[model samples]
Target: MANTFQLEILASDRPFYVGAAEQLVFPTVDGLMGILPGHESMVTIVSPGELKYLVDGEWHYAAISEGFAEVRRDYVLVLGDAIELPEEIDAKRAAEAAERAKERLLHKQSIMQYYHSQAALNRAMNRLKISKRHNHEI
Candidate 1:
């Protein structure tokens, strides 16, 4: 049997997940990272993207935004600005948001506004992608 480690994912105001996982995959600033039990301990910034893990003989996934994870030998703690399950994403809403962001990007705006719009666009795209994949899964 694979060794299990505690995985605790924290959102802004709530605990998202608290359970045992055999492995974890999260988006880091550098790229995607996978962690296993007895892995090296480290802390890194996580980007907005899909975070997945294997647990209880199945795979679980979450959309995480602007988070960082602390990986330890027997535990991984993730704190994020936002986190949501694929099922929680409303595809229509996300599509609308993506359209809005795209429109905003096409026009002239302050640097901050442009960045914000780009970020929104990225988030919406990721949510849409995750939702699509989830829907196809039986």
Candidate 2:
């Protein structure tokens, strides 16, 4: 069996990461899902949350927005609406966004609007949490 798999993470604006990874873990609609090399092929809806990948014995993390992932035996592809490394996250901006999303939720709008607001809030909160955890670990 292979020890690593090709991992590619693409954001709407640009390619976020492309390299060989020993393992990968990310959020899905059902919950957290993990992938290993030589895994079965499948596709899944990725939820907004922290994405972790192991490369060269080190783990790297990123915050990813809603997207889809295509998994194959030797490769995986992630296409997210947005993706940001821990260092790239702005805690202050994320916090502000979270507050705005919360306010929008409280106002109560159409179902679509409510869903959007909830998604926004989830993304912002995930970013903030990841940013804080990364900073503290440094």
Candidate 3:
């Protein structure tokens, strides 16, 4: 599509995506945000959740970690702490991690530990959700 824009998803460990996307949807600390070609330029913090991108009339999904997004008129750059595609996610492993994180939360711990556990739980849940909804791994 002529309206498509460049999208680069940079994971801390590796580059996740580098291509033209017709549309984009990602999580933010405030909420979910969408971007399209010619959108205004801005930067916002990203939250762990399902990142959706439309390319060649197809919507792709990925499990993204906390980071930030830079939006521009002709491009959108996502600098993610981590990123996992559907095929990379293991349903059973994610489920087990989620359960472990939940159990950890049930017990008292330091503030940092609580936050770490929460982050783990959130990532696991997000991965499981995306895997089940998109990959039919339920």
| Model 2 per-residue lDDT tens digits across residues 1-138 | 339999999999999999999999999999999999998999999999999999999999999999999999999999999999999998999999999999999995999999999988988999999999888854
How much lDDT does each candidate structure score?
A: 0.91, 0.94, 0.93
Q: Residue-wise lDDT of candidate 3 within 1-138, one digit each (tens)?
A: 568999999999999999999999999987889998999999999999989999999989999989999999998999999899988899999999999999999999999999999999999999998888877635
The stretch of ten residues in a row with the least summed lDDT in candidate 1 is 129-138
TM-scores of the candidates in the order shown:
0.94, 0.94, 0.94
Off by over 4 Å in 1: none
Candidate 3: segments with Cα more than 4 A from true spot: none
| Local error of candidate 1 at residue 12 (angstroms) | 1.2
* RMSD from true fold, candidate 2: 1.8
Q: How accurate is candidate 3 locally (lDDT)?
A: 0.93
Q: Candidate 1 at residue 128, lDDT? A: 90
Name model 2 segments beyond 4 Å from true: none
